[model samples]
Target: MPSRADPLWRHRPPALLWGLAALAVAVLLALNLGALGAVYRRAGPAAAVFGPADWAALRFTLLQATLSALISVALAIPVARALARRRFAGRRALVVLTGAPFILPTLVAVSGLLAVFGRGGLANQALGWAGLPTVSIYGLQGVLLAHVFFNLPLATRLILQGWSRVPAEHLRLAASLGFGRRAMWRHIEGPMLTRVVPGALAVVFLICLTSFAVALTLGGGPRATTLELAIYQAFLFDFDLGRAALLALVQAGLGIAALLALAGFTLPGMAMTGLDRDAPAAPGGMARLLDGIAIALVAAFLLLPLAMIVLRGAPHLAGLPASVWMATLQSLKVAALSVVLLAVFTAALALAAVWSRRAAPLLEGVGMSALVASPMVIGTGLFIMAFPFIAPARLALPVTALVNAAMALPFALRAVLPALHRAEADYARLSASLGLGVGAHLRLVLWPRLRRPAGFALGLGAALSMGDLGVIVLFAQTGGETLPMQLQRLMGAYRTQDAAGAALLLLVLSLAAFTLLERLIGGKEPRHAGT
Candidate 1:
């Protein structure tokens, strides 16, 4: 407190970081708001709030999202409970695998779903052999199925994290009291579920609401279109800029309303604290039987599609088209660029949030905006703003990378902020007393402490960028296709084998990138100054 000789900003550089972060967010918002302004200005009295088609799309979007959220949460309960209490041979492996779907490319997942549920797919083949009618997975049913496939594992993991928070002493006390399965669930699991389930449901619902790739591929026709898909159709197909802008605004409004309504029910923090330890509980025959069944069913549901993709795609790998390879290279470039952008933005924002008292809340809010801002809205908004000067098609890759980085910033921040905060808390005074300047402090103190989480965040960004198809759709034309876009094209051309092969390649690349970054940079253990 008495050190007048200290550099003014040596303790923290919040202003600089805040300016950088705020500028990025402002650009995104300006693009969206600018598009809305252009639409209203150009359309004059012709602008609308909703057309009949829009109403239909809204209804379908809400219906599918609600169903997907409910089903994912309800089904996750039993599976999460089983995972919480049981120690099995592959328990850790199962938990790790649960995170796969979250990073898995959407088109790859859609292809896998199609392989297991389409007309000539395994399920339909089995039904035909049994002289039963085959079910169609081409409408709302297909969309729900795909959403559940993507979200169930996520729900289970989130709820499992909730379970992990239960104090070990309480479990020991329950075991000492000879609490049966019913009593255990009544007092323990039920309370945890009450606290976690609503937030889980809300998050899943919001995710499904903005779903584009699933609806685009499996949503049969106009009947199953979501609001995001509707915006795409309006702009790309009908060339209706006014309608697209109105839909983007509507989608944004819906997302904002949902965010406000669910703001109180904050999702459980996803940070891995390395605090989980086995809790004592009485094992019973019935409990074990039920847990086994729950685990088996969930495993089958999650794994079968991936298995089908591997089996079906293997034979076609050698015959993959040259376009697929080109798209793969393009996808890698986009993902690498996105990771770099995301890392810079997230690091700056995280530092600001930790160091600035007044700006923390505002910076955090901007980061969280990525969660509610539909990719379509941002893509359409930017498209409108760019259309006046340069062709949007030429800027497709860069724009896609930028938007992907923005979309991924929230997750990256989640990974980095906690570690950064810890590092600052532990070493801020030490560095200040040592007269370490900002750059030296960051390089000597923060970098080592932040490496693990930074790597994890970067890995997440890369995987997500690799899989993203939403913005690319609005921008990219024939020669500029990403891997996801290429997969969609193969599917459109009825080249199922090639599409499956491409899907497999995309999946492998995304996962491998994630794994390599997490392993190589982060290592296996959490490193701290004292430790």
Candidate 2:
């Protein structure tokens, strides 16, 4: 138990760290809010651009995001249920694969989907073989499909988590009451999802709202220009910075309002930090064939396209320029820098959170609210914000790394805050008496006790930065590309073979780099560092 006279702030590092993170996020918000001014200045008046075309885009955007969110959540249910209850061969690996979409490059997934579903895609070819009509993947519907592909796994993970949280005691109580599956669901699962789905839906809705590459590539007509895509068009194609800035401002506001509202629902007990904790035990038999079929279909949905990524691309990488090798090195460099920046930033903020009660709440609030600002929105804002002073953004990989690291801040806090709080609860008084300074204390005290979280936090930050799209989209040019960016350009130019090779290269490198980092850190520490 924590001793008294511990004066909540007496030796509080976690709270202090969190408070600083809150401030960082607040500063970020101010920057985006400034984008609002940029919008009004550039677009003339709201009345000017709020005409029919704008209204149409708004309606279409809402429609697409809603459909995407619904599809994502609906499809997640059975898959999540299967994941929660069953443990078969390769089950763990499958669950991990589901998480791939969250971190996978947008272009890679789009390319794989094209391989499987495009005009000359495997799906169309299969249909030809069967003498069935081939479906077109070029419209609002196609955008929804891509969003669902990316978000379903996350939603499933979230719902299944809710399912897992139904305490075993609750299950035992239901069993003793002779509650069958339906009744059990009524008493337990229903309530959990009634709580979970609202937040999940809101989150998916927000993510789909700001999507760029997906909407740009698949949203075939003017009917589906997302705000992010609009910003790209104004800035990149038209050189209309004024119009782009206005759209960007509106996008930022939309993101903040939606995210803050959603965050309100998810603040306490909604750990949805994208961590895939194993489900607690729940028994299910082969009573419903549909359940089994649902699981198989989901597994297929999760696996088949990803397999295509590796199989289709493995052979084409041999002919690429040495520049590809340089890009890979550049990716490592950016990831390394971003990971360090994130560690320092998250550590400081987390300490603030622990030290100051007000600070913790504020950071949590900001982090939660960040869900609304997709990497695309933030990256656009940052680029627009940075460009006048920092010309040639491609060379500013350091800046890109900094922004990406900051973007990953919320997740780092999530991974570290809990562990830090636990450590403080366990050792506050002792540390206060010892009066250890930062270096000595970190070396002897916190590092030993909290190494797992530290390692995990560092790994997560690195992985997020490694897979990040925001900075790359805004900063990278044709002359320089991360594997993800190159993959995108390849697909955009219809070099599907090369795109596949790039995706394969990205997956292998990202996994290997992160694994090596995790291992190296673990080796460096020797005792408590995590795998």
Candidate 3:
């Protein structure tokens, strides 16, 4: 047993390690705020204020995000209910597949979207065959479509988790009462949606509000511009740091406001249980036909673009340029470093929050701030900070990795904190009663219990890092390209086949990294004493 004053105090609960972790987070925040402040001081108050153009961008951002949120949630309800009530072949696999888009790189998803929805793409071709007017996917409609594409599955998964929470006894009682679908929904599912939908809507809206690459690629014109895209244009294209800083401030304000608006609708924990248990199946009839159609349509909608990417890119895989390969290596390195950083940051903060009940919310709040702190905003601030001190372009890889870690921190924290809390609640007393030291308890108890969620967080962080394009765009120079940036260059140069191949490669890599990390870390379940 170690004394309170032991040299291993650093490993104990309520240790200074948590403080150090908090300090590191503070420094990261400070550097960005400091840069923003410096820009404000230099630019003056007038430069930071919004103009008519800026207001237009703000309006577009809100409108698209709002529409996207509503449509995603609306479409998700049937799909989620279908998934919840019906356990068919590959249903579990489909549930897992739903998570793929959330981690799929923005640019990669955009490429796939364009292949399916762009002018002269499959949808238009089909419409032409039908003698129907063609639709375009290069404006506000396109932006909203892409947002729904990415977020619909996420909304489904979240709502499906809520469905899983409907108490089995309550459901059984409904069945005993001869309740039909309408009654079940009225008494059981409707209330669950009331609890789940607002938070889901708010989350999806905030994510879309920070849209950058999707808008950049498909925005098509000024009318489609988002605040994030404006920030990128202000800094990269116009070299106007002051305007970029101002826009970043405005973006932050909107994000904070949106968060405050949604703050009352608490997000359900990501940790899921009892999924293996079967619920009372909804009676088969027209309901089954509707559910089947809903499931089929969603599967097609979610999977067709991916199929197109694969079909188109398969022929071009061998022709990928050396530059693309090099960029892939660079991306892997960045993602690896990002996973390490994110793991340390998330674990420390989560543990610290669990240890200090009074400061838990504040500590967790700091972690969640990454959600609203747009990557481009952070990158712009860091670029401004690094400009005078070093060649900002030279530090692109490291800065990108750091910003990627920061960007993924919020999700990682969400995945981890709940699991940590549950593990602590379940095992804390048992370990303490056994006189296990902090280090021993963590290694023997907490680590085993936490492996699943930790792996999930790490996988998500790695995938997001690998796919990130925001900060890298601000700092990348010759020879410093990431895979996403490299793919963008390929597309710019009319290397369509090559870009498609690279998109396929990136998609495969991102999914593989996420799958491998999650499985490898989340290994086989542990056996308990009796079992």
Count of clashes, each model:
0, 25, 0
Estimated TM-score for each candidate: 0.91, 0.84, 0.93
Q: Write the per-residue lDDT of candidate 3 for residues 1-531, one digit (tens) a residue.
A: 755333242335555667767775785576457657765665555655577878889899989999999999999999998987887889878777766788888888988888888887899999999999999899999999899999998899889879877766677678889997789778887778888898889889889988998998999899999999998887778767678787878788887887887776665543433334345667788989999999999888888888888898999989999999999999999999999888888878888888767778788878877767767767777777788889998888888888788778888887888788888888776776677778887899889888988898899989999998888887888788999999999988989999999999999999999988999998865665531
Give the residue spans of candidate 3 off by over 4 A. Answer: 1-16, 42-46, 267-277, 525-531
lDDT over C-alpha atoms for residue 508 of model 3: 94
Model 3, position 525, has a per-residue lDDT of 55
Among these predictions, the greatest TM-score belongs to 3
In the range 1-531, model 2's lDDT, one tens digit per residue, is 545535334444544454556567765565445544444454455433444655666677778888998999999987777666666788778777777776666666777788789888888999999999999888887898889888998788778878776655566667677787799678777767878887788878877887877887898878877777776766667756566665655666776776766767754563333233333355556634566787888878767778888888889878766666767777778888988877777776677666667657766666544555545444555565566777746545876687667666766676688877877677766665676555565577666656666676677667666665655776777666676666666767877666678777887766665556656664454453321
- Lowest lDDT block of 10, candidate 2: 270-279
lDDT, model 1: 0.83
lDDT of 1 by residue, 1-531 (tens): 637444335355747776886776675566456546765565557756687889999999889989999999999999998888898798888877766888899989888888889898889999999999999999999999999999998899779979877877678778999887789879877777877888788878888988999998899998999998987887778878778778777777777777776776764543323334456754768888999999988888788888888888888988998999989998998998998888778877788778775878888877777666767767776777788999999999899999899888877887888888778778877777788888888899998888888888889889999999998988888888999999988989988889889988988999998988887778787544532
Total clashing pairs in model 1? 0
Instruction: Note the residue pairs that clash in candidate 3.
Output: none
Higher-ranked by TM-score: 2 or 3: 3
